[model samples]
Target: MSLGAFFLICAMPLLSGCAGFGGNEAPPPRPIVTAPPIAVQPPPAAQQPTGVARDPSKFFTPAQMAGRPLIRVAILLPFNSPRADIRSLSNALYNAAQLALFEFNNPDILLMPKATGSAMLAQKAAQDAIREGADLILGPLFAEEVGAIAPIAHASNVPVVAFSSDTKVAGNGVYLLSFPPDEDVNRIVDFAVLRSMTKFAALYPQDDYGNRVRASFEKAVADHGSQIVTSASYPPNTEGMNLPVQRVASYGGRHGALLAKRSELKKAGDAAGLKAIENSDTLGDLGYQAIFVPEGGTRLRALAPLLPYYDVDPRKVKFLGTGLWDDPSLAREPALEGGWFPAPPPEAHAQFVERYRRVYGAEPPRIASLAYDGVSLAVALSAHAEGERFTTEALTHPDGFAGVDGIFRFLPDGRTERGLAVLEMHPTGAIVIDPAPVSFGVPPAL
Candidate 1:
């Protein structure tokens, strides 16, 4: 079997271009009915991509087609890597994309799969796809790999739909389909701003991921006309969490005030009044009304109990978070209960999980759905203008595309904004405080 330089290539070549694609057709009037905001149920398995080879009249209308090329797609992934550890992840992603294309089952579209093991190898594979005349490309999972192949794809005027979660490597003809931390931070913090939270503080870990979350938190807070009053970072561990937690809670001032007030009452010899307040921790209010803890999983559990011990009570200071707080395990910690954050609607993903488990015979990672959504979106776009499907104009559709993680769209700048719901932590799990909207036609009311 001939590989498309990247993957198994079809012997057939398409003759369609995006030029005559409905150019002369009149634009339809704006629809009175809106598309569903988010699709919880996956698209039916029998669905097909649009523009399956007909009499060429569909895209060209007989007059325009004259002779154009059909759309060709190249899928790039680290299928054979030196690192054996990530083989499962890469295969899962590849399988998801394959599923999307399989479900599409469009005869008009031509596909190529490119496998790369390193940055240099990815560049070689990408060049092969371009040589094969691929109109669109999908994936190269890591940031460095995306960085390596993006220029090659761009040189060929082909847009890449990459699955890298890192947003820094995005843009210039590459679209990252992975969930970036900015989306989670922006959604949750905006919800906080909507709820009238003014002052924010953070107890973040001293690491790259923590820094990214903190940066996103800061930007979100500033954009909302709020401010971060304090931020403290600690090395990852239970060993040194006390210092950072104390600094974030402002233990010195709070405890100092308590001691001073207690001294004042003692000097006056009002033993009864002193007794009434001696057992209390609060003597002065914390500067921030909300504290954003971006920690997740076991690390979050370690940090949570430290807050109340430092005289910082969640009862007073609202606990805020990103998707990191979505873990059901966090609910076991009483301090995390009632904490608020943003995440995709769970019901939609629940359906996907069941479906995927049935097919794969194992539970797929959450990110596997991202791969499916990316390929599925490409199929949807191919219906309109196959060759020009990856245009900036087409990709940044304001209404966005509904995927396994609800609805998301690419911004003109290439940042992805997802329609997310605010969830509150309960002993049972993270429950939706506000349901995600059906469409982002209107921004959520502040």
Candidate 2:
């Protein structure tokens, strides 16, 4: 099996493929959009302080937009790779940009190509478009491809809005429009702290996705004054019962890795060994009351039952996860009775699904939502960023625009301020348990 499969197998339990929700709630006739919206709650308070006030003049002064030339914008995505769902991705990006453009009625905005199918092709395409007087570029979706072109675009001073979740590679003019699971992990820890669930124990796969989320969760927890009592990482792929069983025996001890005291590092070998097992629990032991899992929907279902085997009662412990667990399968899993995961409102997703089906016959894929949001956001910027200079003043206007994802605005630092809702998973299905909007504080003074 592949490394991804290997890691996932070790970290999660075996389960059948997810079946649709088992409820009388008909999949709410597909929305005109790909997914329907969750029942709308009262909109959260607007104008809440972003915690950081930005000096808008630094990025976009009034003098910038004046008399700038109109420039074309290029959007490139792999629409031909053998393994990729090119048509769906391309259509979602195209449709989203088109939808936003239609509302703005701007003639300067131009969509570059139908789509590029490979990284090499996308790089060449972007270069060609830039030479052809394209002012700004949008997309080149995959992370590896984005890394390949970001430097090229940065050198040319052309901004790109890429649908890549790897924040480590994003820089100067390249804004990531994709949502990283790491960000969700940070948000989950923040919410966990607010609820006074401090001691955390993590069991995550040792891979890029899992490691990224683990780091963010640890950072957030520490910042919030909570402690990570124990954190045990499993190899990316594990099979049979031996792996988890052994991991439990090795890492769940009173003097396990997590319980080792940092202050005792200078001691002799005897002290170090002793510290490693301090405050640790026995095998199949759960040392913390809260567990933050960063996993895909399928993996989450597999890991659910193991919590109890490790002496962690799912009902008693607060389980936190990301939008990855937004699927109905999570709610239906008996072992995931009290899990809480963050997700965009269901009604909103339903509506988008309906719209996508109406436009293209089938449901929009999950990743397609990011493509849609990315292009729509870029189109919003293009509508007003006329002439030669893409004015920061226009992009960060006091009155921000709403997009398919949510109400949002662009920060001068190239980060986006998004409004997201948290969903709670029940045995039957998920409900929008928390109505509060997570505010990405405003851009810091730059």
> Which prediction has the highest lDDT against the true structure?
1
- How much does candidate 1 score in TM-score? 0.77
On a 0 to 100 scale, what is the lDDT of residue 96 in model 2? 54
Q: After the best TM-score superposition of candidate 2, give how far the Cα of residue 181 lies from its true spot, in angstroms.
A: 3.0
List model 2 lDDT by residue over 1-446, tens digit each.
42222222321221111123235634323222322111123223222211122232322212433444444667776655555456556666665555434433445555555245555655665666566556667777777777666767777667777777777656667776666675577667767778878888777767788778877887888888888876666654434433553354243452353435433553555676566655434323455668776676656666766666555667667777777886765677776667777666465456555555554566666666665555455544543424524555554543344444544455566655455567777777887766534333444332
Judge candidate 1 against the unseen true structure and give its global Cα lDDT, from 0 to 1: 0.72
lDDT of 1 by residue, 1-446 (tens): 11111110110111011111245854222212211111223223422211122232332212332354556677777766768757677777766666556645665555567776667766766766676667788888888888888877776678888888788888888888877888888888888888889999998889888989988898889998899999999988798999999998888888888889899998999899898997887587889889998888888899999998998888989998877776667888998888898888877676656555545667777678777777777766776645456788777766667766777777666667788888999898888998886567753231
lDDT for 352 in candidate 1 is 57
Judging by TM-score against the true structure, name the best candidate. Answer: 1
Off by over 4 Å in 2: 1-71, 84-108, 114-118, 236-242, 245-285, 392-401, 436-446
